[model samples]
Target: MHICFICDEYPPAPHGGSGSSYRDLSEGLVAQGHQVTVVGVYKNPQWHGGKGVDETINGVRVVRLPSSPSWLRYKLQTLSDRLKISRWLKCEHQKNPFDIIEASDYGGWLRFGGPAGVPTIVRIRGSNYFFDVELKRNGDPFEHKIEEAALARADFIGSVSRYASERTLDICKLSHRSCTVIHNAVDMDLFSPSPGVSRERGLIVFVNSINPKKGIEQLIDAMNVVCAKFPEAKLAVIGQDTQKPVDGITYVEKLKQRMKPEFLDRVIFTGRMDRYKGVLDYLRRAHICCYPSHMETFGIAAIEAMSIGKPTIFSETGPGPEVIEHGVSGLLCNPHDALDLADKIVAILSSDELAERLGTNARCRVETLFNKKHWVQRNVEFYERCISSNSHENGRCGCK
Candidate 1:
């Protein structure tokens, strides 16, 4: 089967959960003897060489398109990208056709609809509406309408988690649309535990964009408490420091201002690192991995850490519960409650027995359920179903 993915954040370039998830699925499908093409529209030409650039990475063909002139307004840029993406799909379909086209619900890139007869699936990797609601902010009305139109036009819809799907429906008031839940997965081969790699005794690794949404502030607050309890307890923050500077001070500096001076010395910030080399090495070295995000369609970062057999602490809010079975697989913390997060961290740091048990169980959970091979196969089945259903409908139309 030929599968085409419309993604903005494809890897080798900087990306988030959605792009990484699509990459895993795309590569897995290629390995299974399926043709996979990724159509990515970039806002910045620097992200991909100019425009209409084509390359094959790990057997999957990738086509990159520049959305619009960078100088244009944000809305205008998005509108242009939507039209270009639609045109690309139509032209590509005319040439060889795609069995199924899957797009992220991130920016409603398919608001104009996809190829003339292709079955399109808009996988909910969180939408603007969903994010606004989660973060308690008012989003642009135009974006919400565009996203709703995109979802409404999809032949089928899949979500990374039930929470994300349900919240999207409620937020969009899509009474008729039903979403199938398919959790995001990680590459176990690349993220597996290396028992020989000695773990840093009191090291806790936090991997994600250093923003308020990721509960970094809360994690910092918790670290203060955790450090006091275990003198050696330290945190190594790994990811992009996205926080904008305020009043001539950087966001990291602002965070430091609130920290206890003694505890401050232990925390280290390694801004944005390569996933394969930097992030993986840190995860392998850490005794514990924490992703206390306030929102996640599906917490892939936490799962990545868990897959590495490091005891993980995921947020109780959002889809963390679905990913981790509380005390069984990994620990869950109230992301908003600093004290609770601290206690959870302290519990894992204080007992090596519990950490090992949780870490072992966490690895088992990922291997058993969230395995990339397993989920990629599931995606193939789902795409086949969508394709067959579309064909049947077309047949009925011809008969009529």
Candidate 2:
């Protein structure tokens, strides 16, 4: 099957979980003898200078379009960008028709008419509404409207988690049949426990952008409690601050200032490590992985840690409970409660047997549910179903 992915972030781009997840799926599909092409937008001025580039990365053909913004047309920029993407897709489609064009909800391109006639699938990796509510941001009303419009036109919508799917449907008032839940995959081979890397005793790692929604403040507060019980315990924060300061100080700086003088020495902030190697390196060394995020469509970092056989702790909020079985596979903490997070962290640290049991269970759970092969196969089947359904409806495989 021939598939094309339209996403704003891809490899070598300032990406988060969505970018990495898309790249993994595309590359996995290509390896399974499927033709995959990715159409992405590059806007990072520092890296690519917002210039278009076409290249093949690990078997997947990636075409990046320049997204250099024009302040003069700021209000109409989104519409113009969508038009530009649509034109590019049309041109690409002429060269080689795609069976399915999966456009991510990240950039709201599908809200406008996507490539004309292509069976477009809007894969929602947390909609704008979800982020606005979760992150407590008053986003542009026009952007939300644009996303709603795009979702309405999608032939099929896939979400990384049931929580995400249900929330998007409720917020957007989308039809039940339009969206389906598909959990994100983790590369088990790449994330398995490393024998070469020695684990750090009492090291608690948090891997995500240092932002309020990520529950960074809660984690920091929890660390204070954690250190009181276990003085040897250390917190390794790995990720950059994606958002600016809500107050006068940046979140990173605020965290630094908030930490007590004594406990400050126990905390280490390694801002934005190399996702490919750096993250895995940190995970391999850490004794416990804590992801107390306020909301997540699917917690990729948590799963990655679980895949590495690390006893992971996630917030009960959002999709964490869906993936983790509380004390069985991994521990779950209250998103806003620092004491609860600290208690959970202490529970694992105090009991070596419990930690091992949870870690082993987590590894098994990831292998059973979040395996890359299963993810790729599920996506391929979904694409086929969407194509078949489109063919039946339009007397062809393409959208009308």
Among the numbered candidates, top lDDT falls to 1
- The lowest-lDDT stretch of 10 consecutive residues in candidate 1 is 391-400
What are the per-residue Cα lDDT tens digits for candidate 1 across 239-281?
A: 8878788888888887887689978899999999888999999
lDDT values, one for every candidate:
0.87, 0.85
Q: Quote model 2's TM-score.
A: 0.95
Off by over 4 Å in 2: 45-51, 134-136, 245-249, 395-400
Candidate 2 — which pairs collide?
111-150
Measured by TM-score, the strongest candidate is 1
Worst lDDT 10-window in candidate 2: 391-400
Q: Estimated TM-score per prediction? A: 0.96, 0.95
On residues 1-400, what C-alpha lDDT tens digit does candidate 2 reach at each position?
8899887788777888888998999999999999999886666665445677788899998888877476747657778778787778778788998788888776677755555656888887887776886667898788888887787778888899888888877778774555777899899999998789998999999999888889999999999988988978999999998877776777788898777888998998999999768888989999999999998889899999999999999989889888899999999999899989999999999999999999999999999999987999999889888888877876233433
Task: For candidate 1, give the lDDT.
Answer: 0.87
Candidate 2 global CA lDDT score:
0.85
